[model samples]
Target chain A: MKRNSRLSLALHTLSHMADDPDRVRTSADIADHAGTNPVVVRRVLGRLREAGLLTSEKGHSGGWKLARKPERITLADVYLALDESLVATANEDSDPVCSVEYALHRRVSGVLREIEQSLVKRLGETTISEIR
Target chain B: MKRNSRLSLALHTLSHMADDPDRVRTSADIADHAGTNPVVVRRVLGRLREAGLLTSEKGHSGGWKLARKPERITLADVYLALDESLVATANEDSDPVCSVEYALHRRVSGVLREIEQSLVKRLGETTISEIR
Candidate 1:
């Protein structure tokens, strides 16, 4: 599994936006601050916008701004916007004939599901406002 | 971030081993059952052995077996052996000037640590014997 840094980057960007909600920040500005490329910043922020946590404008003076107050944006919202599964099974297609494998998959899947729920619940407990 | 299937694969392999403790399973055999390459199986299982959950013999008729009772092995053991951090920060090294990023990192890090502890605790609650 490859470690994902998008959530970290997004949270960093969002907190910066919350610090000065009245000031519209461009993707370039975010990218520079994040020490990454603008494309990466745009991609992450685009998801946040789609999730309605952010709003973007097209004009020169227009850029990105938070759609809702920082207090309302939870880390769980950011996690969902990133659209990555918290856990994944090794066998994409399991063999039904292998009962041992079947039982193992079922048990691990149950545990992973619980872990994901706990993670998301914890994320929901934290807001961007609180972090910033 | 790419989703990792190593833990799932390791659990599947371990449960299979537990199913028939008397059988010595080779990496090739495990790979065939896992629908993955032998090298991948060796890498994952090697980590398990290093963590004292498995034992391996090198010559002919030599293969892999559980180092401890199935009931003694926990998913947390496998997770720690994998040597991958449960959560990774977007910025490997944070910039001191960016207080917002600093604060976000600290807060998210705290939540992630708690999540990891919860996940490990849940994993410890289930032994390979229970799953098998």
Candidate 2:
């Protein structure tokens, strides 16, 4: 499967915030470090905020910061918030009704679910603090 | 990161071959099962043949079959042949040279490599024979 960039950006940004959990990182600053548009950075951070992974402020001096200790956050949390898939699966339209196709999809789906669980379990074991 | 569908199709095809291990499945058959274009199925199958995952034959009875025993094949091998990424990483254009961005990329790259290793290791442990 193709690698998606958004998830990477989110994790990288979270790691930075984890490094200095006490300080607020303006979206501009994060955008500068991420080398992406400030709007993009804000959009990702906004999701994190919505998920309670981080908190943000809108004022001049305000920005974003980890909502909780880095030790409490996991990569899985970030990934889930981003709604990324760990395993590749046939698209819905790839094959709709043949019994063989159905069987294959069922098997592949099972494998993906397993892999997703494994990935989440691994990510859950590592806190944002540990990455920093 | 969002999982791409192409890789899944490639792997699913290989798995089917590994199950039978000897039968030559036609492009039309595979496409019928995969619910995709015969051309798309052939294209993916072509790559597998190139990678020695399977061999294809032409003409009325010609189709595809695994190049090797399921026991000799690994999911990781199929995944690599499909050229799918296991971890999400920032896109090249996301940020081009900021120190923080670079550093983050480096770290994430390292992690991806590690995860890739772990994933392959696990996949390698299971052969197509075992899956079937």
DockQ each = 0.37, 0.41
lDDT of 2 by residue, A16-56 (tens): 77777899888888877876688988888888888899888
The residue ranges of model 1 lying beyond 4 angstroms of the native Cα positions read: A1-3, A94-103, B1-3, B94-111
Best by lDDT: 1
Q: What is the C-alpha RMSD of each candidate to the true structure, in Å?
A: 3.3, 3.1
Local distance difference test, per candidate?
0.76, 0.73
- CAPRI grade of model 2: acceptable
Clashing pairs in 1: A1-B4, A4-B1
Scored against the true structure, residue B66 in model 1 reaches a CA lDDT of 94
Question: Model 1, range A22-110, lDDT digits (tens) per residue?
Answer: 78998888887777888888888999999999999987787899999898999889988887666544335655547756666677677
* Candidate 2 lDDT by residue in tens digits, B10-113: 76777777667888888888877766688888887787788898888778788888888878887777777776666745346544566766776677666656
Candidate 1's residue-wise lDDT over B49-75, tens digit each?
988999999999999999988878887
Cα RMSD for predicted model 2: 3.1
